[model samples]
Target: MNESKFFWQACRLLWMSGILLVLISWGSDVPVSTAVSNISYATTITVDSSRDVSTSLSERCDTHTPCTLRRAIVQARLLAPAARPVLIQFDIPTSDVGYDASQELWELEVKSTTDPAVFRTVEGGQVTIDGTTQPHGRVDGPKIILVGPATGNKNGLIIGVNASGSHDNNIVRGLGFQNFKDHLTINSSHNTIEDNWFGLTSEGQQPYLRNDNPQDGSGSAGVVLISGAEQNLVQQNTFLAFDGVAIALRGNDNTVRHNQIGTNALGLLTLKQTSPSLLCTPEDWLGGGGISADGTGHLIEENIIAGLRQQIFAISTQPDAIWVQSTCTSCTIQNNQVGVDAEGHEVGVCGRGFYLTNTKQVQVIDNVLAETYHSALFLNGALYDANTLRGNIIRKSTPWLIPDDSPKGDDAILRFTGLPDPLEFFNPAKITHIEGTTVSGTAGDGSPCPNCVIELFLDDNDNINEALESVAVVTAKADGTWSATLPTPLADGFGLRTSSTTAQFNTIANISAGTTVGLSELYMPGYVGYLPLITR
Candidate 1:
């Protein structure tokens, strides 16, 4: 009985050993299938006549199937290699699949391979990349080219090129992207989007409907919805009739140069709100103000901004033209021409030139302002203490109306009323030399206030009271005239005194109960000085 039991135990152990061997062999063979699935051969599946065909990449290379354009893309992607670039060309236009304005014709999905950056997808579609359709997965590579008639149905292109890394050296060129409710989002950095046309014609409703929740329209944008991207460039593109904005930039250290942005509800709004949690707030919405910038260390130069309806208007009741809310510590806005209104009427308009708010250490120089309705440069609700405005030519800004006064073109310079006490009565009209260095002439309406006190204090320290002893107070005679000889040397170093100043003459008599006040001339040297009077 003991011998029989031992023999049965030995047989049981042998059966267990054979099962372990089978499991090991199966594990080793499974990788072979995985490797085969990842590697694909070069194959072309054409659809000359209309038919839907389903075939694997291996079978496609052996037998060319006549398939629809959408299915052919799936087959091509399935058989692509990790390192090699694949070129899929749709030569024929077939209507057998039916016209789907929602979905694009060839929707290819490039899955997350072993190394996505090494693989590229090149598509030349005869039809459009409609908004309702979903394209393939994220493709990683140095280059992604989509050429042909590609329209954003109401939605735009979802190019998820950068998942990791600081830079995405991707190139998207030669495609027509239009009518997208939302922006064609480019999440990657260091990319180039060039030679594209984006705009909208619909006025009744919003431009695009969102995918997750279809109730709201995506809000039209020209090209590239920039979020968290830096050091990227958008150039040489034409934008028209978008509801929200042409191009909105959220990231910093980026450059938007040499682009023609015009005739939309708004144009090129830039926001610098970097908080990820607060990205979708209403403050980020683009109404107008071509190319708004909120972040720091950004350069907005050399772009033509024309026909901007309200180039600078607030989303809420707040007023500003180019609203710079973020702390852009050191930025430069130079060599740009703003406010040549093609429509020729400026009402409810902001930033005819610029509206700066809560920003410091900015330099605005060498810009031309032509035919603007508001102030050529408006600084409101903020301190422009350390900022510099030099060499800017502001011409033809007339009929300045700011919800308060109806000042004509003669009241050209506009400044905030009620400043500090020492500079309190500082009129912008007094400082601005409109007729070039002659303050003794008649005012805008030819009526001269001859007794108007014009004080001009010089830079040098000179005692006019001690110099002219007997005639200390030099009072002007009639005919609105006053003249004073220099008690000290009238050379470069000496300046005029404030106390012993003279008054000018008056032409119109002040009618106080039908009585006339005598005319007098008041002259203060520093108050009526010309261009070379003050030195920086």
Candidate 2:
């Protein structure tokens, strides 16, 4: 058959199949026949529901006006996965305002309602659930997108991997989620989950609400990617204030980069059901937390973990801000920080920095750890052949101090040669400029960290941990005012981070945008703590 005849035959076949299709030329603006089976199209579904099916909306809902999130997802799945497939956009009219004061956000609260009523499932392979269409990203405005069940046992959003993507190729971006047990269960690969707030506020800075229950349920996890979730990018999202771990990565070969990880009982967790019996939350959580990477060949780089202090017996317990355990052999954790208050006062506990248990050949490089009860990094009985640990900075109180007095060394790095190898050069570089630097700042709550040390670092291309040295270190006064007069060096940029010893909160600020020689009052605005200058 000639090309013209083939085209007409294709068109006739698609029309007979009765599938709604729109075909456009791949290279030009010429109109193509989507009625042909060779042509695939795109569908856009708009949601306007503030309530889940359990409340007021219809489940198994159509892809028409007054749509719900569940309906949009379900309708999108109807069209067989295609190259240019469906898009689920939002025009959600929310009743509640968000952290910002000028924006009106969209909210989806799921509760006591699942299946039958609305056939609650968001099934898709080539679908994009974009929440950016609404108002978002303002300190006191409304959340542009919010999805969570208010009162029921509804699991948030369960997504299956795409048919043809390298790793989570599906897109779940620019949205806010809360309340439901687990926010997202991404079974896809090669997808991008960027600019979203999971278990956090619309601004991705503070926790929308703190759901801390050590009792009834497993609490909630922001995102849970099961096995086979390879090469996916989970970045720039806020995993904060959940009852359980923030991110649980059961997959392998993934990259989690440049995200603001907030305080929860457990921040990030990675594990396998197979080998050496990993110790997670139920095991007293002393093994590791904040960011747990226990998968093979994973990269967790340049992330900030703040306000993640777990309470024990009414006092804050020392937990690993980053846990590298299980059989996560050959994983790299670099330039991550704990005990960071974004260059401000202490609001977070800044618990134990890094914990490495039963693992081999894990590399931990260029991290800043401060204000911990026990030690910065801990290693257990599992170091055999070759492992590299270096370029880490640590500041902490004596283990024999009032609250943390456990007779443990208040040392910078706690090594179990059976595990950790903090080489002499990689040992904690003094964050304290005891003689020559002036540092002053208040807490996130407008107070000062009493008797805390201030450290100033030279910012080399924005990396202040291993790339820069401590230019100044000073102790804070009773009123939180701290200063040290030292000769200033001319450098490209500078990083200043401060934390209190007695107080659990922390913050950071950078002098990169300051005068050559002037007072830089850092500001970290949030509840727990931040590193506007951990500057990470």
Most accurate candidate by TM-score? 2
Q: Which number leads on lDDT?
A: 2
Deviation from native of the Cα of residue 264 in model 2, angstroms: 12
TM-score of 2: 0.59
| Model 1, span 1-536: residue lDDT tens | 12222322332243223211111121112111111122242443443322334323233322465544334444443443442223233333334342222332322222222321212222221112211111321111101122112233334443343424322533444334433454355666655565444442222112222232222223355554345566666654445434455666556666664454553322322331224343223333222335566566666554555544321223332222244444554566665555432222212223345655545666665555544445556543333333344434444523343444432221122323322221112221122221223323222123333443333223233311111111112333343334433334334544332211112211222111111111112233344543331100
Q: Which ranges in model 1 have alpha carbons more than 4 Å from their true place?
A: 1-154, 161-167, 200-219, 224-227, 264-289, 310-321, 341-351, 382-385, 404-536
How far in Å is the alpha carbon of 144 misplaced in model 2?
3.5
* lDDT tens per residue, model 2, 1-536: 12322332343344224333344433323322211223133666676665544343333346344566666665665655553466677665444332223434555554455442222444556567766555333322224445443442356666664323522346776667755566677776665565456655443333554343433222256777777667667765656654456677656777776555653212332111112132122333221135666568877765667655332334545445677767677787876666553333222333566777766567676676655544566655533223445455554432213234542343344444443232111111112233223433432233334554444444332321222344555555655555555456333244443322222222212111110110122222222222332210
Candidate 2 minimal-lDDT segment of 10 residues: 510-519
- How much lDDT does each candidate structure score? 0.36, 0.48
Clashes of each: 24, 53
Give the C-alpha lDDT of model 2. 0.48
* Per-candidate TM-score against the hidden true structure: 0.45, 0.59
